[model samples]
Target chain A: MSIELEIQLVAVVVSVACSLAGVFLVLRRMALMSDAISHTVLLGIVLVFFITRDIASPFLVLGAAAMGVATVGLVEALVRTRLVREDASIGLVFPALFSIAVILITRYAGSVHLDTDAVLLGEIAFAPFRRLEVGGVDLGPRSLWVMGGVLLLNITFIALLYKELKLSTFDPGLAAALGFAPGLLHYAFMTLVSITAVGAFDAVGSILVVALMITPPATAYLLSDSLPRVLILSAVIAALAALVGFWTAWLVDASIAGCMASAAGVLFLLAFLLAPERGVIAVARRRSRQRWEFARLMLAIHLLHHEGAPDAANESRETHLGEHLRWEPKFARRVVSEAADEDLLVRLQDGRLELTETGRDSARKAMLV
Target chain B: MNPLRDLLFDYTLRTVALGAGTLGIVAGALGTYAVLRRQSLLGDAISHAALPGIVLAFILTGMKSTLVLVLGAALAGWLGTLVVMMIVRHSRLPEDSALGIVLSVFFGAGLVLLTYVQKLPDASQAGLDSFLFGQAATMLERDVVVIAVLGAIALLAVVVFWKEFKILSFDPEFGASLGMPMRSIDILLTTFLVIAIVIGLQTVGVVLMSAMVIAPAAAARQWTNSLSVMVLLSALFGAMAGVTGALISSTAQHVPTGPTIVLCATVLVLISMAFAPERGLIWAAVQRRQQRRQIRADAVLGDLYALAGHHESEHAHDVTVLEAMRAGRTDVHRALDILEERGLARRDGTGGWTITRAGRAEAEQAGESGPDGQHEREGSA
Candidate 1:
C-alpha cells in the first residue's frame, strides 16, 4: 500500500480508539483532564529524551503515559485538598509541567531536535515515514501499530470490566460499599486515558486529540441516552470526522490538525441543532407546537364550558365564535378551521364554532397528559 | 547583571510589571465570584474566545491601540459567554458541554481569522503571533496606565456592590426573594470578569491568563473559610505570582514571561494544597492519625472502667496496675501508657493503680460517645 493510504488508515483507527475512550471520559466529566494529560505528556517526552537520546525509543510513550497519569494524580490531589477547584487544579498542573518541559528543551537545545511547537502540535503528515519492522517484515507505520495495540488493550480492559466500570461511574459510593474499590477503578480509568492519549499524540497532536476525544463523545451524548449506544455512536462519528477532515484539509491546503478540530466542532454544532428529542431546534419547535396545540385545545374547552351543551341551538352560536374568543379574527378562524379539519370542532351556519364530543374528551385528555 | 540591571531600569520592564500587577489584582478579585458561581472555566473560555474579536477589531479598525483591542476582546468574551448561556438554557445539554462547544467553535474561528490576517499585506501584523503567547517585553507605559485605570474601576465596582455580590453568590434565589436584581448583579459580575480577563490577556496570553484568575483563588481558599478573607488573600497571592513571575523571567535572559508567571501561580497552588492548615493534605493526614490515636486511648480507658465494675464482692476497693493492664488485654498496654503520661491514671502503694479524677471523667465521656466519636458529645443525649 502507498504511504498516504497507510497514514490515512492509521488516522481512522486511532480516531476510533480515542473516541471509544472519549465516550467514558466525556460522560464522566473528564474531557479537560484528557486535554491536560495530552499537553502535559510533553514533560514525559522531554524527560525520556534527556535520559535516552533516541526520540524514537518506545520508552518515550511509556514515559509520556506515566506523566499523563501523574497529571491526573496531581489534579485529583489538588482538588481533594480544597486548595483548588477542579478547573483550577487543571489550569495549574498542565501549564507548569508543559513549561518545565519547554525549559528543559531550551536548556538542552543543542543535543535535541525537540521543539515546543512540534510537541504541542505534532507532524501527522510525516507519521508514515516512521515504519515498524517485526522479524524483518515491514509492518507499515509504527504509530498505527502502537495505537492499534493500545486500542486492543483498551477494548479488552473496558469489555472485561464493563459492569464494574459502569457501576463505579454511575454511583461510586454504592460501588464502594459493594466492594468494587472505586479508587482502583478510577486509577485504572486514568491509566487507560493516559495510554490512549500517548498513542494518539503522534497522529493528531494535543489540541486535535483533545477536540476529537471530547467533541465526538459530547455530540454522541446529545444523540443517545444509553452508554453502549453512546460509545458506538462516538466512534462512528469520530471516524467519519477523521475522513471528512483529512479530505477538507487536503482540498483547502490548511493545517490538518486544525481542520480536524474544526470539523469536530462542526459535527457538534450539527448535533446541537439536529439531534432528535434533545437538539436545540427540535426542542424549541416541539415547545412552540405544544403551545399552539394547547392554545387551540384551551379555546375549544372554553367554548364547550360556556356554550349551552352541544345541542342544536348552541351549534348555531358556534359559527359566530370569532368575536367571543377575543383572539385576532383571522387567527381565531384559522384555529377553528384546523380544529374542524381534525374533527375536533364543527363550524355552524352563522360563522360560530362548536366543539364536537370528540373535542371535549380530547381536550380533557390533553390537560391530563 | 550589569546590562540586565540597566535594562530592568528601562521603561519596558516597569510597564510590563505594572500591567501584570494590575491584571493580577483585578482578575484575582473577580475570580472569587467566578469560582463561587462554579464558572471558573468561563474565564478560560472567554480568554480563548476573545481571539477572533481581537483579529476582527484589527481588521475593522486597522489599529493596534490597546483600548480598541481590549474593548473588542471584552465584547467577544462576553458574547461567547452569552452564547454558552443561551445554548444551555435552550437545550438539554449539560453546562460543561455547552461551554466546551462554544469555546472550541470560537477558538477555531479565531485560528482561521489569524491565519488570514497573517497573509495580509500589513507589516504591522508582524507581532500578532506574540499576542497569542503574550509579549510583556514589548509593553508600553500607556498600556500599563490603561490596565491600572481599569483595574481600579473594577475594584471600585466590586467594593460598592460587595454585599449584593455576597448575597447573589451564596444564594441567588433568596437574594431574588429579598428584592435583589439577581440577573443584573450576575451581569455586573460577568462584566467585571470579562474586563479582568481582557487586561490579563495582554500580559499572560489566553491559555495562561485563565490560570491567573483561578490558581490564586484556589490557593487562598485552602487558607481561609470566610469569603472576604478568601478574596483578599487571593488578590495578594495573585500579585505575588505576577511579581515573582516577572522577576524570574526578567532575571533569566531566555525565559518567557507568561509561562513563568503561570508556573509561579501553579507553585503557589501546590504549596497551599500540600501545606496549608485545616484543608491541606498534610493537615488532613495528621488529623486522621490523631483521631485514630484518640479512639485507641478511649477504648482502653473504657475497658478499664468495665473491668472495675465487673464485680462488687471481689477486690471491690481497688485493683493492681498489673491486673488492670492484664485484664484489659494486649491492645490496652500502649493506651495505658498514654493515659498514665496524660495523668489520667495513678499508681498507688504495693503496685495497685486507680483511675485519677481525669481518668474517671474520660471514661464517662467515652461511654457516652457514639460510633463516629468525633461529634459524640454535641450530637448524643
Candidate 2:
C-alpha cells in the first residue's frame, strides 16, 4: 500500500476507536477525563521505555493502560476527600504525572529518541516510514496494525459491555445494586480509553486524540437521542473527519493530526448549529415557537377572563391586544394569524377575538401544566 | 556563601528564578479563585488555546519579543474562554464538553500555524516552539520584567477586589441578588486568570502551565480551611516551587525547567495530602483510631453496668461474659484497659470484672446522652 493510504487508514481507525469510547465519556459527563488520560498516558510510555529501553515493547501498552486507570483512580480519590471537585482533581492529577514523565525524559533519557515535542505533535507522515516486517516481507506501516488492533479491541469491549455500559453510565447506583459492579466497569472502560489514546498518538497527537474522542461523540449527541444511533453516528462522523482532515493536511502540507482536529472541529460546529434536536438553531426555533404559543394562550385566557365584563369588548378587540398584553402591533398580528391558523381563535363580527372551545381548553391545560 | 546568596549572584539563574517565582505567585493567587469556583480546567483550556495566538502573533509581526507574544497569547486565551462561556450558556452542551472542544480546536489551529511558521523564511521562529514545552533558561531580562509588571498588576487586582471575588467564587447568585454586578466580576476574574496564564506561558509553556495555576492552590488547600490563609499559603508554596525548581534544574544537566518546577509543586501536594493537620489522610486515620478506642471503651462500660443491674447486687461478674459479648476478645480487652485507666471498671483478679461507683455514674451519663453519641458516630463516619 502507498504511504498515503497507510496514513489515512491509521487516521480513520484510530478516530473511530476514540469516538466509540468518547460517546460513553460524553454520556457519563467524563469528557475532560479523556483529555487527562491522553496526557498522563505519556507518563506510562516513558516509564516503560525507561525500564525496557525499547519503545515498541508490549509492556509499554500495559504500562500506559495502568497509568490511564491510575489517573482516574487518583482523581476519584481526590474528589472523595471533598477537598477538590471533579475537574479540579483532573487538573491536579494529570499535570503532575505528565510533568514527571517529561522531567524523566529530558533529564535521564536525553540520549533516547523520545522527546516532548514528538509526544505532543505526533507525525503521521513519519508513521508511514515505520513499517512492520513479517518474515522479511514488507507489511506497510506499523501504526496501522497497532491502531487496527486497538480499534478491534475497543469495538469488542464496547460490543460485549454495551448493555452494562449503558446501564451504568445512566444509572450507576441501580447498576451497582443489580450486581454489575459499576466501579469495576468504570475502570475497565478507562483502561480501554488509555490504550486507545496511546495507540492513536502515533497517528494523531495527544490533543487531537482528545479532539476526536470528544468532538465527534459530542456532535453525534447533538444530532441523535438514542444510544445506538449516537454510537453509530459518532463513528461515522469520526471516519468522515479523518478523511477530510487527512486530505486538508495533504493540501496544506502541514501536520495531519492538527488538520484532522481542525476538520473534526469544523464538523462539530456544523452539528452544534444545525443538528435536529439539541442544536443551537433548533433550540432557538423551539424557544420562539413556545413563545408564540404562550402569547396565543395568554390572549385566549385574557379574553376568557373578561368574557362577561363591561370592558370585555375593549379587551377582546384586535387593537387592544397591542396594549392589553403590551405586545407590538406586528407581534400581535403574527400571534393572531398563528392562532387563526391553528383554529384556536375566531374573529367575531364585532372585530373582537373570542376563544373557540378548543382554545379555551388549551389555555386551561397550559396553565394547569 | 549561602545558596540564597549564590543564587542572587548568578545573573542568568537569578533572572530565570525570579521570573518563575513571579509567575508562580500570580498564578497561585488567581488559581485560588479558579479552584474555589471549580473552574480549574478553564486554565488548562485557556493555556492550550493560547498557542494559536502566539503563532499568529509571530507570523503577523515576524517578531519574537516576549511582550508582543504575550499580548497575542492573552487575546487568544480570552477569546477561547469567551467562546467556551458562550457555548455553555447558549447550548445544552455542558461546560466540560465546551471546554474540551475549545481546548482541542484552538490547540489544533495553533499546531497548524506553528508548522506553517516553521516553514516560513523567518529563522527566528525557533523560539515559538519553546512555548509548547517551555525553556525557562531562555527567559531574558526583558521577559522577566514584563512578567513582574503583569504579575504585580494581577496580584493588585486580586487584592483590590478581594471581597467581591470571594463572594463571586463562593456564591455568585447571592452576590447577584445583592445587586452586585456578578457577571462583570466573573469576567474580571477570568481576565485576571487569562493574563496570569499568558505571562507564564513563556516560562511554563502550554502543557505544564495549568499545573502551575492549580497545584500550589490545591496543596495549600490541604493545609488551611480559611480562604485568606489558603490564598497566602498558595502564593508562598508556588514561589517556593518556582525558585526551588529553577535552582535544582539548573544544577542538574538535561532537566527541563518547567516540568521540574511542576514536580516540586506536586511534591508539596503529596506532602500536604499525607501530613497536613486535620485534613490529611494520616491525621484522619489517627482521629478515627482514637474515636474507635473511645467507642469500644464506652461499649464495655455499658455492658458492665448492665451486668450489675441484672444481678440486682453490687458484685463482680465473670470477665468472660464481656468477652463473650464481642466476637473478638481484643476489642473487649483493649476496652477494659481503657476503662480501667478511666476508673470506670476493674478486674477482680480471678477472671472477673466489676463496675466501680464512678463507672456506674459514667454509664448513667452516657445513657442520658446516648442520642448524641449516635449522632456523633454518624458524623464521624
Candidate 3:
C-alpha cells in the first residue's frame, strides 16, 4: 500500500478503536472523562521521559496509559469523597495534571524533540514514515500495527465481557446483586478506555480522541437503539470520516487529525438534523402531526357533544368553530378540511362539521388513552 | 531588589501581570454562573471551539490584533455553545457528550485552519503559536487594555441584568413562569461566558482557558452560598492566581505563563475543596470521625452495663471481658476512660470495673435507643 493509504488506514483504525469504547462512555454519561484522560496521559508520558530520556520508548505508552487509568481513579475517589461535584472533579483533576506536564516540558525539556503540540495535535501524516522493521525484515508503518493491536484488544475485551458489560451498564444494581461485580467491571472498562484513549491520543491528538470517541458513537445512537447496531454503525461512521478527513487534509494541506474531527462534526450535524427516527427534523415533523391529530379529534368531540342541540349548526360551522374553540379561522378551516379528508368528520354545504362513525370512535378512543 | 517597586517599574513583569489579571477577573466573575448552571463543560467546549475563530480571524485580517482575535474567538465560542444546546434539545445524547463533540470537533477544525495558515508563505507563525500555548513573555500593554474593556462590558451586563441572570442561572423555569424572556436571558448570559472565555484564551491558550473560568468560580463556591459573594470572590481569586502565576513564571526560566496561571487557580480549587469551612473535606472527615467515636463509646458503655447486669450484687467486669465483647476497633479502654470521666463507671477493689448508678442509667438509655447511627443521604451539587 502507498503511504497515503497507510496514513488513512491508521486514522481509520485508531478512530474505530476509540469509537468502540466511546459507546460505553457516552452511555455512562462520562464523555468528558475521555477529555480528561487524553490530557492527563501527557503527564504520564512526560514523567516517564524523565527516567528514560527517550521519547520513543514503549514504556512511555505504558506510563501514559497508567496515568489515564489513574485519572479515572482520582476523579472517582474525589466523587466518592463527595466533597467535589462530579463535573468539578473532572474539570479540576485533568488541567492540574496537564498543566504540570506542559510546565515540565517547557522548564525541563525545552531542548528535546518532545513537542507538546505534537502530543496535542498528533502528526498522522508522518505515521507512514515511521516504519516498523524487525532485524532485516521490512514491515509496514508502526502506527498501523499499534492501532491495530489496540483495536483487537478492544474487540476481545468487549466480546469476552459483552453480556456482563451490557448487564451492568443498563442495570448496575441488578448486576451487582447477581454477583457480576459491576464496580469491578467499571474499573476494568475504564482501563480499556484509558488504553484506547492513550493509543488514539498518540495517533490523532488529544482533542480528536474525544471527537472520534464521542461524535461517531453519538451519531450512531441517534440512528439506532440496539447496542450491537450502535457499535457497528459507529465504526462504519468512523471509517467514512477518516476517508473524508484524509481527502480534506490532502486538498487543504492541513492536519489530518484536525480535518478528521471536522468531518465527524459535520457528519454529526447532518445526523442531528436529518436522521430518520430521532433527527431534529423528524422529531419536529412528528410533533406537528400529533398536534394536527389532536386538533382533528377536538373537532370530532365538539361536533359529537352538540349533535342534537338547537345551536349545533352555529357552533359546528367550520368558520364559526374558531370563535367557539379559540382557534384562528384559517387554522379551523385546515383542521376541518383534514378531518373531512380522513373521514373522521365532514363539512356540509352549509359549512358545518359533522362527525362520521369513525370520527366518534376516534374521539372516544383518544379520551380513553 | 524590592518586589513591589519592580512590579510597578518592570515593563515585562507589569504587562504580564496586568494582562493575566484582567483575564482572570473577567473569566472568574462569569464562570460562577456557568458552574452554577452546570455548564462548566460547556465553557470548555466554547474555549476549544474558539481556536478556529482565532485562526480564521488571523487568516482574513492578515494581521494579529488582540481585539480582532478576541472577537473571532468570541464568535466561535458562541457558535459552539449554541451547537451544544441544540444537540441536547434535539437528541438523546447527554449534555457532556454534546460538550465533548462540539469542543473536540471545533478544535479539530481550528487545527486544520491553523495548519493551512501555517502553510502560507507569509503566515504570522509566532502569533498563532502564542494563541496555541500562550506566550506571557510576549504580552503587551494593549492586550491588557483589550481584556479590561471586554471584561468591563461583561461585568456591566451582569450588573444591569443581575436579577434576570441570577434567576436564569438558578431557576429558569421559575423565571419563565414570571413572564421573563428566559431564552433571551440564557443567550445573553452565555454571551457573557463567551466573552470571558475569549478574554482568557490569549493568556492561557485555548486548551487551559476553561480552567480560568471554572476554577475560580468553583473555589469561590466553597466560600459562600450567596451569589454576589461568590461572583466577587471568584473574580478576586482569578486575579490573585493570575498575577501570582504571572510573577512566578516571569522570575523562573522556561516557565510558560499560561500553565502556571492554571496551576495557581487549581491550587485555589484544591485548598477550597479540602479546607473550606462548611463544605470542606477536612471538616466532613472530622465530623465523621467524631461521630464514629461517639457511637463506639456508646456501644462500649452498653456492653459494660450488659455485663454488670449478667452478674448479681453489682458485679464488676474484667477489662479482658469488655475487650472480648467489644471485638475489633471498639477501643474499650478509651470508652472506659470516657465512662469514668462521665462518672458512669468506677474501678472496683478487685481491679475490675463496675457500672455506677449513673453509668447504668446512661447505658440503659443508649441501649433503649438502639445503635442506629443513621447515615443521611448526601445530596451532591
Candidate 4:
C-alpha cells in the first residue's frame, strides 16, 4: 500500500477505535478521562523506555495502559477525599504526571530521541517509515498494524459486552442489582480506553486523540438516541472525518492529525446546527410552535371565561383582543385568525368572538392538564 | 553567602524567576476563586482556546511582542469562554462536555494555524511554538515587566471587589437579594481569570498553565479553611514554586522551567496532604487513634466502676471478672495496664485489680460525660 493510503488507514482505525470507546465515555460522563489518560500515558511510555532503553518495546504499551489506569485511579482517589472535585482532580493528576515525564525526559533521557514535541504533535507522516515486518514480509505501516489490532480488540469487547455496557451506562444501579458489577465494568472500560489511547497516540497525538474520541461520539449522540444507532453513527462519522481530514491535510500541507480533528469538529458543529430532532433549528421551531399553540389556547380560554359575564361583549370583540389580552395587534390577529382557520373560534353575528364546542373542550383539557 | 547573593542578584536568572513568580502569584490568587467555584477546568479551556488567538495575532500583526500576543490570547480565551457559556445555555450537552469540545476544537485550529505559520517566510514565527511547552529561559526584562503589570491589574481587581467576589463565589442568590449585579460580578471575575491565564502563557505555556492555576490553590486548600488565608497561602506557595523551579531548572541541564515548577507545586501538594496540622492525613489518622485509645480507657474505667458496686470491703475486682464483663476482648489486660499507669487502678497481687480513690473520681467523670462523648466524636476529625 502507498504511504498515503497507510496514513489514511491508520487514521480510520484509530478514529473508529477511539470513537467506539468514546461512545461509552461520553455516555458515562467520562469524556475528560480520555484527555487525562492521553496525557499521563506519555509519562508511562517514557518510564518504560527508560527501563528497556528501546522505544520498540511492548512494555511501552503495557506501561502506557497502566499509567492511564493509574491516572483514573489517582483522580478517583482525590475526588473520593471530597477535598477536590472531579474536574480539579483531573486537572491536578495529569499535569503533575505529565510534567514529571517531561522533566524526566529532559533530565535523564536527553541522550535518547524522546521529544515532547512528538507526543503533542505526532508525526503520522513518519508512520510510513516505521514499517512492521513479520517473517521478512512487510506489513505496511507499523501504526496501521498496531491501530488495526486495537480496533479489532475494541470491536470484540463491545460486541461481546454490548448489553452489559448499555445497561451499565444507562443505569448503573440497575446493572449492579442485576449482578453486572458496574464499578468493575467501569474500570474494565477505562482499561480498554487506556489501551486504545496508547494505540492512537502515535498516529494522531494526544490532543487529537481526545478530539477524535469525543467529537465524533458527541455528534453521533446529537444525531441519535438509540445506543446501537449511536455506536454505528459514531463509527461512520469518525471514518468520514478521517478521510476528509486526510484530504484537507494533503491539500493544505498542514498537520494531518490536526486537520482530521478539525474535520471531526466541523461535523459536530453541523450536527449541532442541523440534526433532525435535537438540532438548534429544530429546537427553536418546536419552541415557537408551542408558543403559538399556547397563545391560541389562551384566546380560547379567554372567550370561554367571558361567555356570559358582564362586559362580555366588549371583552370578546375582535377589536378588543389586543387590549384585553395584552398582546400585540398583529400577534392577536394572528392567533385569532389561526384559531378560526382551525375551527376553534367563530365570528358572531353581533361582532364578538366565541369558542366552538371543540375549542371549548380542548381549552378545558389544556387547563385541566 | 556569596553564592546566595549571586543567585538572587544575577540579571538573567532574576528576570526569569521574577517573571515566573509574578505569574505564579496572579494565577494563585485567581485560582483560589476558581477552585472554590468548581470552575477549575475553565482555566484549562481558556488556556487552550487562547492558542488560536495567539496564532491569529501573530498572523495578523506579524509582531511577537509580549503585549500583543497576550492581548490576542486574552481575547481568544474570553471568546472561547463566551462560546462555552452559550453552548451550556443553548444545548443539551453538559458543562464538562462543552468545555472539552471548545478546548479541543480551538486547540486543533491553533495547531493548524501554527503549522501554517511555521512554513511562512518569517523566521520570527519559529518562537510561536514555544508558547505550547514554554521556554522560561528566554524571558526578557520587557516580558517580566508585562507580566508584572498584568499581574498587578489582576491583583488590584481581586482586592477592589473582594467582598463582592467572595459573596459571588459563596452565594450569588444572597448577593442578588442585596441588589448587587451578580452577572456583572461573574463577568468581571472571568475577565480577571482570563488575564491571569494569558499572562502565564510565556512561562508555563498553554499545556501546563492550568496546572499553575490549579496546583497552588489546591495545595493551599489543604492547609486552611478561611478564603482570605487560602488566597494568601496560595499566592505564597505559587511564588515559592515559581522561584524554586526557575532556580533549579536554570542550574540543572536540559530541564524545562514550566514542568519543574509544576513538579515543585505537586511536591507541596503532596506534603500538605500528608502533614498539614488540622486537615492532613496524618492528623486525621492520629486523631482517630487517640479517640480509640480514650474510648478503651473509658470502657475499662467504667467496667471497674461497675465491679466496685458489688464490693463491700476492698473494692478489688478479679481480672477474670473484668474480662467477663467486657466479653471476647483479648486486650483486657492491656487495658488494665493502661489504667494502672494512669493511677486509675492498681494490681492487688492476686490476678485482681483495685480501684483507687482517683479511679473512683475518674469513673464518675466518665459516667457524667456519656452524652458529651457523642459530641466529641462528632467534632474530633
Candidate 5:
C-alpha cells in the first residue's frame, strides 16, 4: 500500500480506538481528565528524557503512564479530602505538572527536542516521516504501532471488564455492596484514560486528543441512550471525522487537527439539530405542527358551535363563522373551503360561512377524540 | 537597605508583582462562586475561549490597548458561556460535555485567528502570543491599575450578594422557594466569573488562570467552613501565590509568569490538603488516632466496671484492683495503667482496680454512648 493510504488508514484506526475509550470517559464526566492527562504526559516525557538522555526511549511511555496515574491519584486525593471539588482538583494538578514539564524543557533545551508548542500541539503530518520496519517491511509510522498496541490493550480491557465497568458506572453504591471496589474501578478507568490519552497525544496533539476524546462521544451521547451504542456511534463519528477532517485540511490548506475538531463540532451541531426525540429542530417542529393542528381543530369547533346558535338567521356578514375564527383571511377561507368540500360547512346566500349538521357532529367527535 | 531599594526599583519585578497580585485577587474572589456552583472548569474554558476574542479585537481595531482587548475577551467569554448553556438546556448532553465542546471549538477558533494575526503586516501583533501563556514582565502600570479597579469591583459585588450567593449555591431549590430569582442570581454569578476570567486572561493566559481561580479556593476550603472566611482566605492565598510566583519568575529569568503562578497555587493546594486543620490529611489522621485511644480507654474502663459488678452481689459499690485486673482482658491492662495515671482509676490495698468518682462519671458517660448511638436514638425517638 502507498504511504499516504497507509497513513490515512492508520489515522482512522487510531481515531476509532481513542474515541471508543472516549465514550466511557465522557459518560463518566472525565473528559477534562483526558485533557489533563494528555497535556501532563509531557512532564513524564521530559522527566524520562532527563534521566535516560534519550528522547525516543520506550521508557518515556512508561514514565508518561506513571505520571498519568499520579495525576489521577493526586486529583482524587484532593477531591476526597473535600478541600477542593473535583473540577478544582483537576484544575490544580494538571497545570502545575505541565508547567514543570515546560520548565524542564527550557532548562534542558540542548538535550531535548521536545518543546511546549510541540507538546501542546503535535504535528500529525510528521507522523509519516517516522517509519516502523519489521523484517525489512516499512511500516507507515511508529506512532501507528504504538497506538495500535494501545488500542488492542483498550479493547481487551474494556471487553473483559465490560460488566464491571457498566455496573460501577451506572450504580457505584450497588457495585460496592456487591463486593466490587468502586474506587478500584475508578482508578482502573482513569488508568485506561491516561494511557489512551498519551497514545493519542503522540499520534495527534494534546488539543486534538481532547477534542477527539470528548466531542465524538459527547455527540454520540446526544444521539443515543445505551452505553454500547454510544461507544459504537462515537467510534464511527470519530473515524469519519478524521477522514473528512484530513481531506478538508488538504483541500483548504488548514491545520489538520483544527479541521478535525471543527468537523466534530459540525457533527455535534448536526446531531443537536437532527437527533430523534431530543433534537432541537425536531422538537421545535413537532411543537409547531401540533399547535397548528390544534388551531385548525379549534377553528372547526368554533364554526360548528356558531351554526348551532338559535339567532343564526339574524347574523351579519361581519358575524360570519370565518370572521369569528380570526385566522388569517386566506387561512380562514381555505379552512372554510375545505370544510365545505368535506360537507362540514356551507357558504350561505348571505356570504356567511356556517357549519352543516354533519360538520357539527364531526367537530364534536373530533373534540372528544 | 540598598538591596531592598534596588529590588523594589526594578521595573520588571515590580510590574510582574503588581500584575500577578491583582490578577490573583480577582480570580480567587470570583473562583469562590465558581467552585461552589461546580463550574470551576468554566473559568478554564472561558479563558481559553477569550483568545480568539483578543485576536479578533486586535485584528479589527488595529489597536493594542489592554482595555479594548480585555473587553473583547469578556464578550467572547460570555458568548462561549451562553453557547454552553444553550447546548446543555436544549440537548441531552450533560453540562461537562457541553463545556468540553465549547472549550475546544472556541480555542480552535482562537488558534486560527491567532495564526492569522501573526501573518498580518503589523509588528504590534508580536506580543499578542504571550496571552496564551502569560508573561508578567510585559505588564505596564496601567494594566495593574485596571486590574486593581476591576478586582475591587468584583470583590464588592461578591460582598453585596454574599447571602444570596450562599443560599443559591448550597441549595437553589430552597432559594427559589424563598422567592429569590434563581436565574438572575445565576446570571450574576456567571457574569462575575466571566469578568474575572477575562481580566486574568491577560496576565495568566488561558490554561493557568483556571488554576489560579480553583487552587486558592480549594486550599481555603481546607482551613475553614464559613463562606465569608473561605472567600477571604482564598483571596489571601491567591495573592500570596501570585506574588511568590512573580517574585520567583523574576529572580530566575525566562520563567513564564502564568505557569509559575499556577505552580505556586498548586503548591498551596498541596500544603493545605496535607496540613490544614479539620479536613487536612494530618488532621484526619490525628483525629482517627485520638478517637482510637479514647475508644480503647472507654473499653477498658467499661470492662473494669463490668468485672467489679460481676464479682459483687447487687451493684457492688467497690471492688479490689486485683479482682478488676483478673477479670479484664489483656488489652485492657495498658489502658487501665493510663487511666490510673490520669487519676480516673486507683489501685486499692488488695491490688484490685477501682473506679474513682471521676472514673465512675466517665464510665457512665461512655456506657451511654456507642459509635452509632445518635443514629439509633434518632431512629427510635
Candidate 6:
C-alpha cells in the first residue's frame, strides 16, 4: 500500500478504537473524562521515560494507562471532597499534570525526540516510515498494527461485556445492585481508554483523539436509539471521517489530524440539522405542526362552549380569539380561516364563528382526554 | 525595596510580568463568574478555539500585532462559544461533548492554518505558534500595553454591568421575569471572558490557559461565600500566580511560564482547599473529629449519669451493666479514663469509677442541648 493509504488506515483504526470507547463515554456523561485522560496520560509517559531513557521501551504505555486511571481517581477524590466542582476539578488536574510533563520535557530532556507538538498536532503522514519488523521480516506501518490491535481489543472487550456495560451506562444503580460493580467497571474502561489513547496519540494527536471519540459517537447518538446500532454507526462515521480528513489534508496540503477533526465537525453539524427524529429542522417542524393542531382544537372548543350562552354572540365573534386566547391577530385569523377551510367551524353572516358537528365532537373528545 | 519600582524597573521582565498579571486579573475576575455559573470549561474551549482566529487574523492582515491577533482570537472564541450554545440548545448532545467538539476541531483547524502560514514565504508567522504553549519571556512592552487596556475594559464592563451580570449568573429566569435582557447580558459576560482568554493566549498559551481562569476563582471560593469578596480574592490570586510564575520561569532554566503560572495557581488552590477557614478540607476534618469526640463524650457521660440513678452504682467498673454497655469496646475504658482525667469521674482503688457532681451537671446540660447533635450529623453528610 502507498503511504497515503497507510496513513488513512491508521486514522481509520485509531478513530474506530476511540469511538468504541467514545460511545460508552458519551452515554455516561463522562466524555470530558476522555479529554482529561488523554492529556494527563502524558505525565505517565514522561515519568516512565525518565527512568528508562528509552521512548520505545513499551513501559510508556503502562505509564500512560496508569496515569489515565490516576487522573480519574484523583478527579473523583477532589469531587468527593466537595470543595471543587467536577468541571473545575478536571480543568485543574489535566493542565497541572500536562504542564509537569511539558516542563520535564523542556527542562530535563530538551534534546530528546519526544516533541510535544507532534503529540498534540499528530503526524499521520510519517506513519509509513515507522514500519514494524518481526524476526527481520518486513511488516506494514507500526501505527497501523498497534491501532489495529487496540481496535480488536476494544471490539472483544465490548462484545464480552456488552450486557454489563449497557446496563451500567443506562442505569448504574441497577447495575450496582445486580452485582456488576459499575464503579469498578468504569475505572477498568477508563484504563483501557488510556492505553488506546497512548497508542493512538502517535497517529491523531490528543485533541483530535477527543474530536474523533466525541463527535462521531455524539452524531450517532442523534441517528439511532438502540445501543448496538449506535456503536456500529459511530464506527462507520469515524471511518468515513478518517477517509474524508485524509483526502482534505492531501487537497489543502495541511495537517491530516486537523482535516479529520474538521470533517467530523462538518458531519456532526449535518446530523444536528438533518437527522430523522432529533435534528433541529425535524424538531422545529414537529413543534409547528403541534402548535397548529392545538390552535384549531382550541378554537372549536371555545366556540362550542359559548354556543348557547347569553353572551354567545359576543364570544363567537372573530375578534374574541385574539382577545381571549391572546394569540396574535394574524395567527387568530389564520386559525379561523383554516378551521373554516376544514369545515370544522363556519363563519356566520354577522362575523360570528360557530362550530360544526364534527368540530364539536372533536373538541368534546379533546376535553375528555 | 519599593516593590512597584523594582517590578517596573526592568524592561523585559516588567513587560512579561505586567502582561501576565493583566491577563490574570481579567481572567480571574471574569473566571469568578464562569466558575459560579458552572461554565468553568467554557474558558478552556474559548482558549483553544481562539487559535484559529489568531492564525486567521495574522493571515488576513499580514501583521503580527497583538491587537489584530487578539481581535481575531476574540471573534473566533466567541463563534466557538456560540456554536457550543447552539449545539446544546438545538440537539441532545450535552454541553461537555459540544465543548470538546468545538475545542478540538477549532484547534485542529488552527494547526492547519498555522502549518499553511509557515509554508508561506512571508515568514511573519514566525511567532504565531507562540500562542500554543506561550513565550512569556519574549512578550514585548507593546503587548503589555495592549493587555492592560483590554483588561481595563473588561474590568470596567464587569463593574458597569455588575447587577445584571450577577442576576444572570445566579438566576437568569428571575432576571428574565423582571424583564432584563438575560441573553444579551449573558453574551456580554461571556464576551468579557473571551477577551480575557485571547489576552492570556499570548501569555499562558492555549493548552494551559483554562487553569489560569479556574484556579484563582476556585481558590477564592474556599476563602469566602460573598460574591464580591470571591471575585476580588480570585483576581488577587490570579495576579499573584501570574507574576510569580512569570518570575520563576524567567529566573530558572527550562521552565515554561504558562504552566509555571498554572502550577503556582494550583498551589494556591491546594492551600485554599486545605487550610481556608470556612471551607478547607483540613478544617472540616478537624471539626468533624472534634464533633465526633464531643458526641461520644456526651453519650458516655450521659450513660454514667443514667447509670448513677441505679442504687449504689457510683462505681462504673463495678456495674456489670456498664460492662454490658461496653459491648466489645475498648473505647469505653478510654472514655472512662477521659472522664477521670477531667475530674468528671473518680477512680476508686478497686478499679472502678464514680461520677462526680461536675459530670452530673454536664450530662444535664448535654440532655438540654437537644437537636444540636442532630444538626451536626446532618451537616456531615
> Which has the greatest DockQ?
6
| Pairs with backbone N, CA or C atoms under 3 Å apart (clashes), candidate 6 | none
| True-vs-predicted CA distance for residue B186, candidate 4, Å | 2.5
Give me the displacement of residue B378 in model 5, in angstroms: 16
Error of 6 at A366 (Å): 3.6
DockQ category of candidate 2: medium
Residue-level lDDT of model 4, residues B312-380, one tens digit each, is 636677778878877856467887888888898898867678888898887787567776864564365
Per-candidate interface DockQ score: 0.37, 0.66, 0.73, 0.66, 0.57, 0.75
Give candidate 6's error at residue A209 in angstroms: 0.9
Instruction: Give the per-residue lDDT of model 3 (tens digit) for A165-276.
Output: 9988888889999999887899899889988988888889888999999999999999999999999999999999989999999998889999999999899988988999
Backbone atom clashes (below 3 Å) for every candidate: 7, 0, 0, 0, 6, 0
Q: Mind listing the fnat for each candidate?
A: 0.32, 0.74, 0.84, 0.60, 0.57, 0.82
lDDT tens digits, residue span A1-369, model 5: 666566676677767878888888877777788878887888888888889988789998888988988998988877776666788778888888988887767666634578666665566767778888989998668888888898898888889999988888788889999998888888887888778877877767676678888888988988889998888899899888888877876776656666777787788889988998789988999998776656556656776555547765544233453455566766666655666677766777978666677877777999785
Give residue A230's error in model 3 in angstroms.
Answer: 0.9
What is the per-residue lDDT of model 1 for residues B1-381, given as tens digits with 9 covering 90 to 100? 543464468566666766777777788888888877778888877887787788889889988888888888889999988878876777656667666666655665566566667778999877765656676887888888888888888889889999999998899999999998998898888888899998887778765677788888887888988999988988888888887777677667667777888888888877887889988889878887766666666666665566567644123224444445556554455666776788877656654455676877777775666455535632332
